[model samples]
Target: MGLSMFALSRRSDARFAPARSSAELPPSFLGSGIRVRGVLEIEGELTIQGFVAGRIAALKLIIAPGGRVEGDIVAREVVVSGNLNGRIFAPNVTVEETAHIDGRIFHNTITVARGAHFDGRMPWRPVNFFETLDQLPETQP
Candidate 1:
């Protein structure tokens, strides 16, 4: 009877355990020597050190120094320290000093370092607007 009770308590504890956030999950990495041209989707975090020419959807994305991307990115948060010639649709964005961007950024909150080279428009959106990224208009405002 004691063993049964202990098992039940253990199960309860497991059920009530806090869920892990995207930052706490293991990150996926794309090496510097790699190149991909397709849609990339990640549930947790993704770090890129290579070249990608397609759409990327992730919970969090980091473009490391020397990385390059040419396409659209939709994420909850994004950090760029490389080169990008595409559009970004994220609620939170950070452009490091080493970043060079030539496209549009749609964000609710954004931070660009002093040395970052950016030649594009940064459109501000409400937090609720990002809740439905799939419904984004095809034309840029």
Candidate 2:
């Protein structure tokens, strides 16, 4: 038995839009070599390839393979492929092969590669505390 052309054509549908150039994308780059002596706050996704010596807060943080940070980080998600020497607080944290971390980590999910060197205590915490509490039995006051 053989399949008909209509069977393959059925899977091809206009479900996705066309691609756009980098210029058409949103303002995402915070620029490389961002030396911040003070706090570096951001509301959107940020990719760092420089040296930071202060607090960093963003929606999503990406530490490039050549990036280095010497302060704390608070974000929704963090991807580290460089060097970090401070505490990290996020819901999801990933350490790639070139990553090196020497601090504590507080997150719901954490990934460490084989070549990654992380020498710190990772305190696991539930992501949904309210949901867990709601599932508990009601206690009489």
Candidate 3:
């Protein structure tokens, strides 16, 4: 009876376990001085401490302080604390105090710290269909 109960508990735990998706993946890093000059497409989160000269696409991206990326970035979320010189497209973007970005940003939400510097346009948009619909002109039925 005890063995059966233990098995049932294990099965219940398995059923309630968290799903493993790209968004849940841990952050990965690129060491300094290593330069990537082509497109980077990642299924999970990534952190760059080196230099990249091409486009980056990921579920989440973080540019650590002292890192440099000179290409476009498209991700679900992005946190920048380094130097970026290309366009950024993310649902949420946070630029830390030490960040420097020189490209346009297309984000649903953006946060910039006091010491952060951004020299490009930030085009705000809604992340959900409902929010987008709310912004449209009302039409008669």
Candidate 4:
């Protein structure tokens, strides 16, 4: 409803690219058995139930229960119901009660449910901060 994802994609080819419509390719799901190391770029939704160590850029990212991710994440929307040990740069974020997080969160809007185990900082930022993110900052600010 704000700036178009398509327009933003054009500026971030390293992590954002055109993908088939979500209707054509269903949301990607990483199972619990999988462990990945690299960049995960998606135009649609991505549900992670595995272990990942790298960067992730997506329209929507959901860290499912039992999942664990370590690194940076840039997305329009992020919902954490698992474990995360990195930074998140997103406009909207939801941290479920089952989430176990340890890192920084930079969001325009955020909701953290009761019982969530988080050990880090949550920094509020303007929405424009997400639109212009080209690389992960060398240090958490």
Candidate 5:
């Protein structure tokens, strides 16, 4: 996976702690009525309140309560409060109570709140795995 120059410039330490909090960065938002496809790569935070069907890479990713996503996700942190039907690759993952997930989650630390419906596998990876994850593996589904 290759990152944009901007993303490389903003790269953080191994722990994913940037100079500023994710909240401090202006997020890219997708409205509830919108739909998108293809690859999306962001250096900062991304909030999805719509429907997306593709791969996403970001520093932080948030799926709003009514959002829907289908594909692979790579981020430093991920918070899902909606629907997902694919894989998540992150160091820190939070499955909110309103979330519905299927597929797999690969993380160093994770939290799945009560009321969240998830029917998949959660694989634990060392923190260094994320720090050096330059490409996604083509593994078992």
Candidate 6:
């Protein structure tokens, strides 16, 4: 009985765990010298230590310190530790203490660290909203 309960707890925790633990899978890294301007799509985790100016679709995304992104991001999980200047459509988001964020964040759950700098709105959405997000939202002029 105790073993069954332990298993159940582990299963539940998995639902809220990071997309992939560093030990389980290596994250694709973009170095500081790189700069990109286009749509990037990835099925696994990605970590950015450079400059990006476009859309990103991934299972998990991390903007490392000193990195910058200027576009939209759609992912299951997002962790920002640098600068972001656009929207985020994710079920879970974590804004680190060094993060600088502007624009909107649409998330089912979000955490902004004490030292994070933010200048935008965070709209809570149901998980179903993300499930149907096949494309980016049209811009409003």
lDDT of 6 by residue, 2-107 (tens): 9898656634543375665444566799999999999998878899999999989888999999999999998879999999999998888999999999989999
lDDT values for all models: 0.84, 0.69, 0.75, 0.83, 0.85, 0.85
For candidate 1, which ten residues in a row score worst on lDDT? 11-20
Instruction: Give one digit per residue, the lDDT tens place, for model 1 in 98-123.
Output: 99999999987889999999999999
* Model 2: lDDT of residue 12: 40
What TM-scores do the predictions have? 0.81, 0.69, 0.73, 0.80, 0.83, 0.82
Query: Candidate 4: misplaced stretches above 4 Å?
Result: 1-25, 135-141
Provide the global lDDT of candidate 6 against the true structure. Answer: 0.85
Clashing pairs in 4: none
For all candidates, what are the clash counts? 0, 0, 0, 0, 0, 0
Q: Candidates ranked by TM-score, best first?
A: 5, 6, 1, 4, 3, 2
Error of 5 at 37 (Å): 0.5
Which stretches of candidate 2 lie above 4 Å from their native place?
Answer: 1-27, 30-32, 128-141
For TM-score, the strongest prediction is 5
Q: Write the per-residue lDDT of candidate 4 for residues 36-91, one digit (tens) a residue.
A: 99988898889999999998988889999999999998887789999999999887
Residue 38's lDDT in candidate 6 = 91
Kindly list the per-residue Cα lDDT of model 2 for residues 1-141, writing each as its tens digit: 146654343224211111112224442554465676777767667788887777777667888988888888876678899889998876678889999999988777788889999999988766652123223342100
lDDT of 3 by residue, 26-67 (tens): 667898878889878887888999999887877678999989
